[model samples]
Target: METVRTRPGAGRQGGSGRRLTRRQAVGALVAEAGGSPLRRTMGVGQLTLLSVGATLGTGIFVVLGQAVPQAGPAIVVSFVLAGVTALFSALSYAELAGMIPGSGSSYSYAYATMGELIAWVCGWCLILEYGVSVAAVAVGWGQYVNELLRLTVGVTLPDALSAPPGAGGTLNVPAALIVVLAMAVLLRGAKESAVANTVMVTVKIAALVMFCAVAFTAFRAGNFQPLFPLGTAGMSAGAASLFFSYIGFDAASTAGEEARNPQRDLPRAIILSLVLVTALYVLVAVAALGAMPWRQFAGTEATLSEVLVRSVGGGNLWPVLLSVGAVVATTSVVLTVQYGQIRILFAMSRDGLVPPLFSKVHPTTGVPRANTVIVSAFIAVLAALVPLGSLADATSIGTLFAFMLVNLAVVLLRHRNPDAPRSFRVPFSPVTPVLGMGFCVYMLFSLGADTWIAFAAWMAAGLAVYGLYGIRHSKLDHGAGPQEGA
Candidate 1:
């Protein structure tokens, strides 16, 4: 093998780990740019926009309907809990993004600190958080699109082609369409895609603020009575569901190489983006949940915006705008989600842990064409074929696992490579990561049995893929690898 093994915790046990040097990371970025596609397609501004684009999507709109009855008015604390948990992981991610500063985010970190096996597992968990996360968003998007159609044009989509296979429907057609559209945009290159996403982000922000301002005007205190009506059980359930809304914040890390100065920008983007999204979510939840009784909100996906029009007298104008906002947000999320997936594959491909085809950037677009297609198809199938709640819960479980790994990694990296350059460090070191880990673990078990079962199945499938393909193909296996100390 090489001077140092390329496994999780491998860095701790020995000599220099065979991690990719910063130069190698930068070189691969250049090679994948059609050998130079978009010379400078991103900056601090674009990076921040991408962060916002990735994060401010479907969760806020649909999740409120699901969460309101569960936590009552205390759903606010649940959101805060979820956001705090995310901040812990974000702090961990900040350190890794600065130190590794490469594509694949946590996967790359696991590779450098742990090894290929851990990296594969981390990548697999991403399916729940990143890949399936998008599919979940697409399902939410389906709900909104149909809502808009019925409200404005009086054209209701049939349930058969509108939901996943598990939801007693034939297909989720809108979800698949959005995935396809995202793939097309990704194939065009990052700069143009970022531009489109910027517009979508703006729309999403406007819709969120408008929703809060409008609902706040018609607020009533009586709706707060019997808060936590279902007891702590309900509040816990709401917190678990709200986890879905924060999925996109990690997308900031995937731009490790593309950032103007990753050391500085990545940390800023991660923390800043989380703060921004959390603040918006709190405002919207307070306004929407406060305006109506929680018992009336259950079992309906269009509860928030519908309540807005009913309470505020906006009629069709406001609800339509909210629907449009959700659609735009979901579309942009698909784009950024696919982008992160491709770049992670690209990183793995370059390291020879995956088929070389995934590393090949399109001649024209400079994007990883094959990987993008595969991820896009994966999302489309789930969107078109399945309408399962268990899948969404499983997604949260997966994301929490991935975040736990990243959090633990922060501690591991510090002790292993104390000399390594870090643009940001998590405060209180082990305590923060430990708390982060505990928080995620709690959420992981909080998922229902069916969701846990689904998560296990995904993990099993990923193991098979890695065992059959990754270890054998890994560049580190044959002693062909990056610099030892960099």
Candidate 2:
């Protein structure tokens, strides 16, 4: 067991009973990484596929329709902006992931460099980012599932079973069902889920490539006439919406314990996945917009399918194939993101932050089965009852907050441990992280008032949980196995 010894005069607990310093936290993380049993079956290609699969889901299929109405053709600019912000954060993540090589993602980074309270807050924010994101994607997935059923089987799920409580129905059965199924795959093992993700990503990519090919055939230069109809503010708002699409590249970093050579491969995969996903997103956006007026995208639940039907003229197989692609895409997103969430919680639990049940990695499968079940149950409830719009807003805000903290952590680590080995470094140290933080803050404010309200409530709840339970139960306070007083 790894233990972090508390300081007498240097650090304060921040209400967690016993505080953890940067050096002590790093020691604990390193010890834990050494003792982990996760299988390192992923290479750069598999890791890249994981990031791409996690990223290329609802953002491309569902968000485009919502963003286009805000910025017209300038939604393309929004994609670039979101990509740039993600690039900065990805570079930061690469640097930290290379150094830490642990499973907690940004939450781990924060713990190692910032302290326990900051780490706890970072983990809580991630719950909003990943957990809520799965719910949102499941809700979006429900749309494609409904469309696929109607297109292929000539059947539509009734509103009572198809829509969420806030979306004119008692529950979204398909959304809830998909979450449950994903939980089953995750419970199997990391390598198993990864293999499944690879096949799904390949088919999903083929479908997008087909959509782009057919869309380009009907492309019209006239569609580019009014590029910025809603102006800069509208473009910024569109960027905020599009930002959610770029939130999953760091999902690659969450698998550090299961990586062959995390220090080198994790950084490479993070940057490579970002480049590939961005290129695909830009191509798809250009193709779709060139093929149809941006105004037509607004209020479209299944925009890509609509684009396929309109471009190729309906009564064909292409639209149905595209609908299937959307299902595969969003399903992959839920899978990868849910995987990231569980690993982060498992890391926290191992450190005696949350309940010990979350840290119980099954001996046979080398997976956190209990954590997966808990997360699945919680997300399924949200997917079945909550509105997608609310869940999405919370996700964007949470992800942006986590990204900002990650950028800050990178700078702090560099100053605190200049001798630490870093296979990859963020090119322009303070400048890059500073700019990344600025972008995150800008996007946070761009989110609606309701999102802010929801975020505040969630944080309040997290703080309460920490004070009432996490503080007294922390391993650092309990004198876990061995002591490392940094």
Candidate 3:
């Protein structure tokens, strides 16, 4: 409907640029051919499930195994600490989602207040958060699938081929396959994806509850002795790790432009999902720690399913069932991540923040087919080639950095447009935003050196692309002048 220019387009550099109304942001983005895949009922409850599907994956099943060993039994405290930080940022996001009410997520928020450059950086961060996370989740899924195969089919794959290069494995076929599979499912469009996502979410939660119920019998208070024997250093590290588990809190904002009533529903979805996810995380952490020794959680080949087996006297069909649930859980998260990527790219493309190709919609599926394939292929390669630990850390850094931007954007928007019809506002105003910023920065710094290097390189690559193309063809330069002026 519009074109973006390098220097300054219609609105700024003497051209007639159009500024969309609040209603238009949500409805217009969905008006491609037949409509956007994101425009669906997805009320608060479904949106909460979306967050759960995304948040409850590797963080609990695989990553927790590593975090538990790092922090000992105090991992419970780590989960809570990380949840607090997420809550702070979620509150800020709710406010912004109410005001902006669009799908760009951090990208749209940044563009609204921080100008063009920062928005591109946020969009780049989202690429890492969504794009890389899909691959990472797939890698975890491949592990679950291999475990399920051995349990059900009575056959085992060689570890040399099962793991990634980081883990001394050659090529992760299962990981790549699942990524492709998720892509196929997503190609069917959002409604179908949401239905599948909901079912997977139910299975994952039920599986978690089953673990808690059965594993309870093996609980021993002594298992938690010297809870902080590793001291503050270990617990802090665990907290940092636990922080990644809460990464999906902001996923709700990416749907802002598509919500049935974004101003109202977006805020509700963002906050409600955060609360549900955090509580679920705390309960899961409590159950796992109470049932086993702190040191045993280094995570076996099967991870969470292994906990059920080793700690819960699991040998019968229960372990198999739990493994199935984990496989479904990880798969659902990958789907959700991919869906978010499409919508974000749609926003950026429409705004000319990136290549317009990302915004192209498939006539059949009403989905971003080309962009989805491109992102999926890239993730498959990453999953097949990279190390899980490094991927996990990189995903965490990307997410934390985005949280920082969302929090700051909330405060700046409130100040810049106090009269805007914000359906929700953060409870503490300046304090909440500042607190959110501090928490994200702390967690961002806690990442390992390797993660820092990968993050820096990923960002540099994004900058190069933006400079080469996006800067010259951006919509912000032309449209969206002072609120009153347009």
Give the whole-model CA lDDT for all candidates, comma-separated: 0.75, 0.83, 0.75
Highest-lDDT candidate: 2
TM-score of each: 0.88, 0.92, 0.87
lDDT of 1 at 334: 81
- Candidate 2 has its poorest 10 consecutive residues by lDDT at 9-18
Task: Sort every candidate by TM-score, greatest first.
Answer: 2, 1, 3
Please give the distance, in angstroms, between residue 420's alpha carbon in candidate 2 and its true position after superposition.
0.7
Give candidate 3 regions above 4 Å deviation.
Answer: 1-38, 158-171, 222-234, 295-302, 385-392, 478-486
The better candidate by TM-score, 2 or 3, is 2
Clashing pairs in 3: 6-472, 10-15, 11-478, 102-257, 103-257
What TM-score should be assigned to candidate 1?
0.88
Error of 3 at 390 (Å): 3.8
